[model samples]
Target: MSRVLLLGGTGDALRIARSLRAEHVYSLAGLGRTPVDLACGVRVGGFGGAQGLVRYLADEAIALLVDATHPYAARISANARAASSDARVPYWALRRPAWEPQADDDWRFVDAWPHVVAALAPFRRPLFTLGREPLAHLDAIPAHQHWTVRCLDAHPGNERARIIDARGPFTLDGERALFDAGGYDVVVSKNSGGAATEAKLQVARERRLPVVMLRRPALPAADREFGDVAGVIDALRAQPFPIVR
Candidate 1:
């Protein structure tokens, strides 16, 4: 009789929920738009903080916790670690394999967001995908620069970018078509760290466009690392969860 509070926003997390559906009662916690075909119960947004999560663990009797959030979401990872430890509960972080720069990939992996904004100085015909909220980061860029930016919202923000609002896990065909059609010379995106959003990178590779990519932030120490939901299930079966995800 185990109950778990799951921290997820990745495809793998949903898969883990499906894999363990027959055996465990799970409560999924995530951000952004809720998925339509998820297989478990859910909560959304920050868990108040470490103390809030601790309270939740005690009140809900969440015997275990699994984080499947985006790898770049460092804040949640830290919160999960501190909360789980303070509550004396077990936890795990499900992370996908990070994309590396291949010979074909002419990516210049920028270590920070500000650097990506600054790259605009030397480049043009740029395609951007820093997600929805970081649009302001582009404000510091020169106004004369023309950019092709994408988002999930229709009216993202007023900026120099020609905003393309669409959804993720985009097809390579569409991504490539957009880049080619737009005559993009450079790609600037975050290491958001998930396949759904990584499609853009693949598209960039196909076009051989130069990239100004952001690196992923750190996660708190976890008991184990899972590349997929199947790995998470296997770990839960084998031993206690990790310290962070």
Candidate 2:
């Protein structure tokens, strides 16, 4: 069994770890957040940077490297790719495909989070399902409308950033209640591309509200790309172990 380092935090990462648990593979997760009951063995905190990551890989004698991070986590992915190359470890990513918009979805796709604010025209009050980092972007765009922002932590500071403290895998009833109670005419969500946060989109669809969708950055031109967990496991199995030269 190869000792693989799994760089992960997102749902896809969790999925991949669970899938490989029975393969007799010894897996360790590299995480920014303190893992709460992770599917595999874990290590928390940054690995310095690309150089630091490479050194850690070398010291641990990691046989494989998987960058199964969030799509928005470009810095870590970049570091993972660079470190894997430097350490001569086989590298792969478990990135999920972005959600496609249906005509009935009434989505306005935007490039950046800041730009998303500008993209919004006059509508009814919006329900913002934004990430913690980009919360300020909502205030950047002109305000002909109001917004309700959701966060796991107690969102303080910005009077403009209306805060709703809650967590993920949001229930359908909860989503519907939020929309109905907030009097939201539209939904603003990141193309996070996971089941956990998807209820917001479903709520928007039910209400026939316009959704401002933030798209993902393009993956680096790696040799492979897998839109699912199964594909990721296959990649892990196919890649040969690092040569101890």
Candidate 3:
């Protein structure tokens, strides 16, 4: 049977994997402390790099490559592009639409975490939802202000920053309650987009909170890019069967 390699990270990856008719393998970088519920056979961790990924695709006879990772996961997306070209497999990127600023929103877009830090200097009692990777920058924040950081898990044991161990599809009411109760002065997050984590933005807007939004990294364009799961399904269905050489 032809196998499509579904690069899994985002919720869309799991949805696409579940929708596939052909044999497929769901691949995760294994960044999460616990495994997410996946729809098909799974592979965890990296394929080393582009070269390693190419070898895996060739060796496993991956016919189609679907990248459905977080918008900020640039390295893996680049690797997938290179590996798919080397392996002669069709590649598609499942990118969700980015959030646009509304009339009431106070958004400051920056390129990276350092820029976020520099922009954040004037704000007090800031809340960061940029996930754990960006947590390293927390040490540089002024000691006078107490910061709140939210993550999927509670592993870091960070006493310096107040940690909220929560997962999302968070609601506007929930976000408002959290912010109101925490008495946050400002908000920081990546431009991750999609519905799952967007409530914080809406709440920020309603509360007149200044949002320090990190612009997404420029990812290599795939042979095709899809905005939704149905588009991805159509793309996969259009591909030829996997070949075992």
Candidate 4:
């Protein structure tokens, strides 16, 4: 049987991995502070860039490659595209749709993080839910304005900032409570477009708080693209089991 290499981290990845357990082997970048419960034969960490991934494909005999990483993870997605071409493996992407604002939503779509920082200057208490990696851009927020940075882990390095470490699937009531306690005037978040972290947006709508939403980067053209796991599974199953290589 031909082996499949799955680049997994997002919810879509988990669903596809579970569905195609017999043919797919999952790999995670392991950047998260917490461990994710995935199926057996899962590998963690980088593959040393494109060349490294090429070597792994040949060594493990990966015939089909699935890129199902986070939307903001452009580097790995690019590497997967390059490495698949180099290794002559077929590839596909599981890209979820981004969330659209309702009539009551007060959203500002920004192209980049710097713009998010610039737009935040007017707000005194700005709430950042853009995740830890993107927090590096928080320096652009002027000294006058106070920031409430929320993430999943407490970094010893980030002791000086007002950091709130929490996880979610947050409820609207919970998000409201958080906003109320912080007295936030605005929210800065990536347009990650999923139900998992969308409660913040709902709360922002209710309070009529302005949201600086960072748009997703454009991905490279994939041989096949799917918005859901079922579509990905259907496409994968349609391909021939054996690769010529």
- Report RMSD (Å) for each prediction in the order shown: 3.8, 4.4, 2.9, 3.3
What ranges in model 4 sit over 4 Å off?
A: 33-37, 137-141, 156-160, 237-245
What TM-score fits each model? 0.84, 0.80, 0.92, 0.88
Give the winner by TM-score: 1 or 4: 4
Q: Which 10 consecutive positions of candidate 2 have the poorest summed lDDT?
A: 23-32
User: What C-alpha lDDT does candidate 3 achieve relative to the native structure?
Assistant: 0.82
Model 1 Cα displacement at 127 (Å)?
1.2
lDDT of 2: 0.70
* C-alpha-based local distance difference test score of model 4: 0.80
Off by over 4 Å in 3: 33-39, 157-159, 238-245
Model 3 weakest lDDT span, ten residues long: 236-245
Across 1-245, the per-residue lDDT of candidate 3 in tens digits comes to 66888888777777776665435788888876424454467788889999999999988878788899989899999999999998898898988888999988899999977788799889778888988865665566587677898987775535567878888789888998998888988899988888889999988888899999899889999988988878887766666763211
lDDT of 4 by residue, 176-236 (tens): 8998898999998988877889999999998999999888997877778898877887877
Cα lDDT of model 1 by residue, 48-103, tens digit: 88898899888887788788877877887899899889988877888777778878
Position 221, candidate 3: lDDT: 91
Quote the lDDT for 19 in model 2.
52
Put the candidates in lDDT order, highest first. Answer: 3, 4, 1, 2
Worst 10 residues of 1 by lDDT: 22-31
Candidate 3: clashing pairs of residues? none
Q: Model 1, 4: alpha-carbon shift in Å? A: 0.7
